[model samples]
Structure formats: C-alpha cells, structure tokens
Target: MAVSAEDFDHRCEPCLVIDQQIEAHGFCVDCQEYLCKNCFSYHQRIKATKHHHLVNKDNMAKHAVIKESDECTEKCQVHKKEVIKFFCPKHEALGCKDCIVLDHRACDIDYIPDKCTGIGDSAEFREVLRELDQKVNEVEDIIKLAACRENELDSCHDRLIKEITMFRKEINDRLDQLQKQIQTDVDRKKFTDKQAVKNVVETCTNISSDIKQRQSRLQDYKASQQNGQLYIILKQAKSKLKSEEIKEADRSLEKTNMQYTFEQNQDLEDMLSRQNAFGKLALSSSL
Candidate 1:
C-alpha cells in the first residue's frame, strides 16, 4: 500500500521536509526516490551515490508523474492520445490542449473526457455494444449459410418424394393383381402392408414439417436483421442524448444540407404496385 506523506512524515529528516510555505512536490523523475526540496541532495550523497537527482520543480513533478498518469480510454484510431476531457468542437474526438494546438485549432475545447464519460464511455456500455454487434453479425451470417442448407434440403426431398411416388404406384399395381388371384373369402393378412403405408405417410409429413420449420426460422432471421439495424441507430441516438453537454453543443452546431424534391406521388404509387418493392412477397402453393 502507498503511505501518505503524513504517514511517512518526519520519519526521516524533519528539517528537510518543507510545509506549504515551500510548495512540496511529490517524488523524483530519474530515480524513484521520494524527497522534499531540501533533503534531496543529502539523501543522494550518503553512500555509494556520487550524483544524486531530484524532482522539486512543477515541470519536474509533472514529468515524474507520466508513468503514473491515468490512462486515456477514448479511442480514435487517428489520434494517439487518450481522450482526457476536452472535446475538439470542430473535430471528431476528445483531446488535450497540446492536441488543440496542433490538430484541434478549429475546435472548441469542452470539459475533460474523464468528467463527462461517466455514463456513455463506461465499461458496461462498451461491453454491451461489443457483445450485441458481435452476436447480431454472427446470427446474420448463419442465416446466409442456411440458404445453402435450404437448397440442399429441397433437392434431397424432391428426389426422394419422386422415388416414393413411383415405388408406391408399382406396389399398388401388384396389390391389385394379387387381390384378383386370391379367393373372395380370404382374410388378407395386411398388417405389414398397412404399417409400411403408415410409415411412408409419417416420413413425408415429418420432412414437410422440417421444411416449414426452416422457412419460419429464415423469416425470423430476416426480421432480426432488420431489427438489429434499427437497434444500432437507437443505441447511438440514446448515447448522444444521454450527455447533456454534447446535446447542448450539437444543438448550436451548423449543419450542411443537400436537398432534392420529387415532382409527383408517382414514385410512391410505383413502389406500392411493384411486387418486389421494399421486400413485398407473394408465395405459391409449392413454396
């Protein structure tokens, strides 16, 4: 655990430790040695130490803390610096003054990123988006793969159905001849034949049910894809609206518009009449 200055205070040289009067800065840069302004040299020269270094100045304190500087969380692949707090009004990222001087000259620097990102840039929000987008993409890709599966099922089922129909027709013609040869009083032992017919009907029904289920899932997958797109837009909108300062800033931001107008309702009528327009569907009995 890191001890406070008070906990370590006067433990060494009492005279070396300065109060607020001298403006005490913490720790050294070149060396990890801790000292107030006065005792640093004496602390350095004590043993095998020939040259002692110290950090007392404001600039030195700032430099020493670089390793201790809190990591920046905001990501803009274009910018290397962590988004500290200040957002560049004209640019697309949050940055510091050093960034402002170089790349963000046209931007209005707002509050530090640390203070404003409590809700939007939190770990929970990031994790949620990452998981949601990943799952949505994965499901959509599976649905596309299912198209090939559906085609295979259709081809396999059609061939088997044709074969079944031909076999049944031959079996029925043989049964008719067998019945004519038998005596009228004969109690035909047809338990096996009845069972075979029942089995065939069941097999066909089961396959038809499988096809229906796949069709339903394909429809649901498409619906989910559409919903996923809208959900993404809504999430972005919610995040934008959540930050008060961002919303306020954007309200006044100038927007450039490009406009074109249609002459009549002809386009709307054409869309309504077109069978495939906007994914309108008409299904056949075979389907």
Candidate 2:
C-alpha cells in the first residue's frame, strides 16, 4: 500500500499505523501500549527511563512474573554484607578481608561489625571522603593551570598572526604597485624597467610565502589551545569526585533502627479471652 503522512495522523490523537493488538498482554512496560508500537506514543524518557508498558503473554505464570533485581546496595552496608570489616583507627585506612586478616594477626584490632556500625567509629568512610576531597582539589588545580596556559598560548598566537598579516599586506602592496607601474610604462626604457620590476616581484613573493607559513602555524597552535581544555579538566575533576562518592557509599554504612520498649506484648491474652466470653454471653442472652 502507498503510505503517506496521513497514515500517521488521525483525529486529535496520534494515529496508529499498525492495527495489531497484544491479545495476550494488556500493556507493554517498554512500549507502554495496549496495542502495537503504532498505537503508542514513544515515551522515551521517564523518571525511571527504563520502565515501559508491556503486555504479558497469555501463558505467562502469575507467580513467575519477574521483579527487577535490586542491583544497588540498599540495605546491606558492607558491600554484599561480607562480614566484620575492620578499619585501623591509628592509620585511618580501609581494610579488606585479606588486609584485616593479615594486619590484625597480632595487634589489637577494631572490627566494625555490619550491625552497630557507626560513622562515629568509621575511619574508612572518613578516609574515602578525604581521598575524594584530594582528587577534586587536584582536578581544580590542573584546570587552573590549564586556564593560565591557554591564556598565554592565545596571546602568543594572536601576536604572531598580527605580525604575519602586517608583513603579508606590505609585500602584496609593494608587488601590486610595482607591477602596475611597469604595465603603465610609456618610455622606451622597457627592457631595463621589466628586469627591475621582475626582481622586485620575486623578492616580495618570497616574503609573502614565508608569512603565509607562519600564519598557518600560529592558527594551528591557537586552535589547539583555545578549546577550554581547562574547563574540560574541571569537569573531569567533578566526574572523579562523583565516582568517589559512589565508592564511598559503596559498602560502608551504618543504618540504625529506633527501638521502642513496647517491644514485647504484655499479658493481653486473658483480657482478650474475657472479651470473647462476654460477647458469647451477650449473643446467648439476646437469643
């Protein structure tokens, strides 16, 4: 069938180009469609950009519906809930399982259990933060340096370009004025005059060629130096800081749950039993 823009538009709603419906599933989590792709607006970005309306197949088991895996460390603090990871209070460093095992072999070790773990006692957390701060500062430093370099390079480039332009203009002017004078010569001194003009042209041409080369080099250098390399380095620094943020949050955490002393059930069984007896007596007495 010959297709046109008309096939894609209808009424106030966007038209469905295809009529096929998902008979099995009522929705597509990806497509967000009761029908086919043609029937749905391609909602590309959402808060959860990955979520889509998808229809379930007829034979799909309700019990077999898969839930998204919790890929993030939501509840567990010691990344993957490994065990009693220890941090050296003296050195203020992170200790992996192997590190803790080897280092605490003889010395007094302070193991931070996953439970009852606190930032107050977490040197590793503090260390990671310190490391992040250091990296961010380093990036900031490089950016500052790059900015200074860019300014200096740009100034040098501009001066060279200006010099080349001035030289090129002077050479062109001399060549043009000399050529015009020769062309307009009226006297019979043509032979001598032509030779003199030729020499002058050669000299000016050589100077112009040299200036062109200098201009090209200066342009190349300026372009390389002008792209805000300093700014990009600043961005890289921020990106590194964010990465460390993820690293710091990775496995070290202490989540505290407030506990109340109404924590246990008192002896309410007798009271409940009496209430139940009273209700039964009322029912019987009414009858």
Candidate 3:
C-alpha cells in the first residue's frame, strides 16, 4: 500500500467529520481517509478495510497513491473468470474451484491464502527459484547448440556437393584424354596396315607378271625346238615358286587381318554397379 501527497493539516478525517480534533497516524487509500492510532488499529482488524491499502503518516509522503485494483487478482489460467484460490501440494500448482473438481480431485489441497503465509520468505521458495533459473539456462544452452548444429549441417552439405562435383570433373577430364589418345592410336594403326597391304599387292603383281613372261618365252622356245633353254626356264621357275620369300609373303597377307577392341576399367564398372551414394552420413555429439 502506498500514499500520495495532498494538502492536509494532519488531522484524522473521520474524527474531524464528527467535529473532533485528532492527529492522524495513518492513511487508508481505498477509503480516502486519515486515521489516528486507535482508528488505524481498528482499520487493520476489520475484514472489509483490512485488505485496503494503508500507509502510516511517517511514510505517506514517501510513496505515490495505490490504486484500488493494485491488489493482485490472479485468475485461473484454465477458468479465466475464476480467481485462483486453491493450492495443490503434490502438483505444486494454483487453481480455481473448477480446476480442483476436474483435475485435482484426488490431491490434498489447501486454501491459497492460508498456504501463502510466510512462503515469500521461505528457504524452499528461494531454492525453487534458483532451480528454475538453472533449468532455464540449461535449456537456453541446448537451443544455442541446436542453432550451431543446423548451420554446420548446411556447411557440410555444401562442401560435400562441391567435392562430388570436383570428383566428377576430374573423371571426365581423364576420360577425355584417354579418348583422344585411343583415337590417335587407331589412326596410326590404320595407316601402317594400309601400307603393308599395298606392299603385298605390289609384290603379288610383280610375281604374276614374271610368271606370264616365262610362259610366253617357253611357248616360243617349244615352237623353235629349243628343249635345253625350256628345261632351264622350267627349273628356275620351280625354284622361285618354292622360295622362303614367296612363302613369307603368303603368311604376311594372312597375318594382316587387323582388329581392335576396348574394355572398361573393371573397378570403375563395379563401383558404378554397387555404389548408390557418394558417402555415408555420420552423427556424433562430441564431434
């Protein structure tokens, strides 16, 4: 209860109204009256005025006036219109009559006004307040940790994506180099094989022309009855036919069948077949 400043001769208002002069010792804000010591004592005893704000004359000028509604009218959270009047010891909660009937029927309850006596200065109350503050701080720490972890998650995701992209780029660059090298090899092989086939064709044509010339000479010799010259030509032609150079040419033409094939890396193929993800995700609290 607080009192406000107002012009006064410091006389009891109730006494002055009855044409009696008495010094005021206190002021009742709700009644707007000044009272002597006796009247102040009676004011404290009476139930109606007991709850009213009262300030002694010694402290009246030090405080502002208290409003009528300044007294706490704490209402039930569940039943908003009903004042909280009961305390449940087991649940450590305040409730209205309806709450007691609905939820706290089996619990031993006490009238809140009676239960509140000396509670404001109790050691248990202070301890409860300390525990509440500690719990609140712990929850705040957990919230901060959650925020940090969320940011870290995003950072890790971005880093993994960049790594995967770099790995893919490296593989693509290597494959491109391999493709160019293989294509160059194929071209060089085609050139060399083409030259070998041309040489074989030229050798076969020269041999056939020599044989045809020999055959024409033999026919002329036979017509002129030159049997000795014919015999020498036949022997020379037979030796040339069985020569190692001619046999080697025949083998070279057969060996000239060129074919090429390419195979993928087995490890790379197995990785593509078996792997579904780039890497596994692991969660650790201690990091």
Candidate 4:
C-alpha cells in the first residue's frame, strides 16, 4: 500500500519536493532541511556538509517547521550574493567567505553549521527562549497598561474641560448678577442726587421770584408817593430775605456737591491676577 502523507507529521523537506513521502528523523540547522535516517547518515558522511549542524526531531519539536522549499537563505550584508558560511564567536557575528577573509581573518572563526551543532538542545538556548517569551509577555503587559492610561487621560481631559466650562459659566452668571445690582445702585444714586439738585433749584427760584414781586410793589408805592406804604413794604422785604429758611437753603446749596464715582474691588482684581484664579490642578505619579 502507498504511504499517505498524513501518516507523518514532519515529512522530509528534500523528499517532499521530489514526492518521496519520507518521514524525517532529524532537522539540519545549517541547511534548514529535514532528513530521514539514511539521509541524515549520508549528510554527515558527505564532505561538503560534514560539519553541518543538525537537531533531532524530538529536540526540534518547537524549532522546526516542515516546508517544501529548504535552503539557507541568509546572505552576507557586505557581499549580497554570497551566503553566510562562517561565524565569529568573539564578536558573535556571521559573514560570507570574502567577508571572513577580509575582516575576520585575525579572529578564530568557526563554520556556521559546526558552531550551531546541538544549539537547540543547549541549556543556554532554552533559557534564552524562555527569557524572550517572558520579555514578550512583559511588553504586552506594558502595552495594556499604556492603553488603560491613555483611556484614563482622555476621560480626565474631558472631565476637566467640562468642569472649567461649568465653572466659567457660574462665574459669568455671578458677575451678571453683581452687574445688575451695581446698576440698580447707580440708578438709585443718580435719581436721589438729581432730585436733591432740583429741590435746591426750586427753592432758589421761589426766593428770587418773591424778591422780584417785592421790588415791583415798592416801585408802585414810590410812584404813588406814599411814604408810609413804601417804608412798611421795604421793612417786610428785608426781614423775609434775611429769614432762617433762606439762610438754611443757601448753606444746603453750598454743601451739596453731588458727583458720582466708582471704585473697583481690589480683592476681586487681585484674585483675577493670580495664576490659579479658578482652581489648581494637582498631578501624582502613583497610579
């Protein structure tokens, strides 16, 4: 019966390309290919691939993935066309043939395949893989924390804006109320001052009219040549003009200096000039 490909989990990459359907026992690290028992023995025996590093199938459970195309794709940075074949342990660097000859000639370099022999099964390699996994988990946690912080920041920003807007509205409303009150006070003061001035003017006009009437009366008496009547009229006019009521009116007019003026609230002005007039924003490092 023909063997179905489903029977093997890790099929030999070299055999899979040729439709051989062979099971792989080992994975070649340098060549990036899987080999059967016979192929693995042959690979080691071959002079070209004698120093090639390989990993057992069981050891490569997490390392190897079977593919149809299998070949070393790593190329040198300096020599683009040449594949990397040597490793410098001192610098932990990889280079091609010309690169090794020119730069790493003084250093004791090793064949990449030989240097990587049984690397997958090494304690250091396993520890490094575990460390990488831990580091990745840490990065994911940090990212999650950053996302939460970003969301919190957005919320805080919105809340603060609303508070500021509401506070400003409140301040404006209070200012409006204060303005109305001050306007009412100003109007009352103006009315009171104007009424006082009008009273003074009325009093002065009445006194002047009375004096004029008295003078006209005296003129008539003089024209009649009536000495007694003229003398009596003159005496009455003099006494009335020098009365206490007239003297009080003159004193009131002199004392009354009605001038409207406004003084700003210094406390309010100082509060506005301060940096944290509305409120202060406090920040803490601890979450």
- Which candidate number would show the highest TM-score if scored against the true structure? 4
Candidate 3 lDDT over 1-287, as tens digits, reads 54433444577755543345677889887665678888899999998889988998887655535444433378889989977767788998888767877788778877654445577789999999999999999999999999998998899889878988998898889989988999999888888877888888888888888889988988998899999998998888888778676567677777778577777779877877775634555666743
Please give the lDDT score at residue 286 for candidate 4.
50
Residues 14-69, model 1: lDDT tens digits? 23211222224444444443455555655566675436455554455455443333
lDDT of 2: 0.47
lDDT values for all models = 0.53, 0.47, 0.77, 0.80
Cα-based TM-score, every candidate: 0.23, 0.26, 0.50, 0.59
TM-score of 1: 0.23
Model 1: colliding residue pairs: 84-113, 85-112, 85-113, 89-108
* Candidate 2 per-residue C-alpha lDDT over 159-192 given as tens digits, one digit per residue, 9 for 90 to 100: 7678778877986798689667755653334445
Which ranking of candidates, highest TM-score first? 4, 3, 2, 1
Local lDDT at 59 for model 3: 75
Clashes found in each candidate (C-alpha, N, C closer than 3 A): 4, 9, 0, 0
The lDDT ranking, best first, is 4, 3, 1, 2
* Candidate 4 residue lDDT tens string, 1-287: 87677988777754543346788999887776778888888899989998988788897576655442323469888989978767788888888767767777778877654446667789989999999999999999999999999999999889989998999999999999999999999999777767777888899889889889999999999999998999999999989867776677767675657566888999999999999988988887854
Clashes of 2: 9
TM-score between model 4 and native: 0.59
| Structure candidate 2, residue pairs in collision | 27-54, 27-55, 28-53, 28-54, 29-52, 29-53, 29-54, 30-52, 79-251
Lowest lDDT sum, 10 consecutive residues, model 4, at 63-72
Q: Candidate 1 or 2, higher lDDT? A: 1
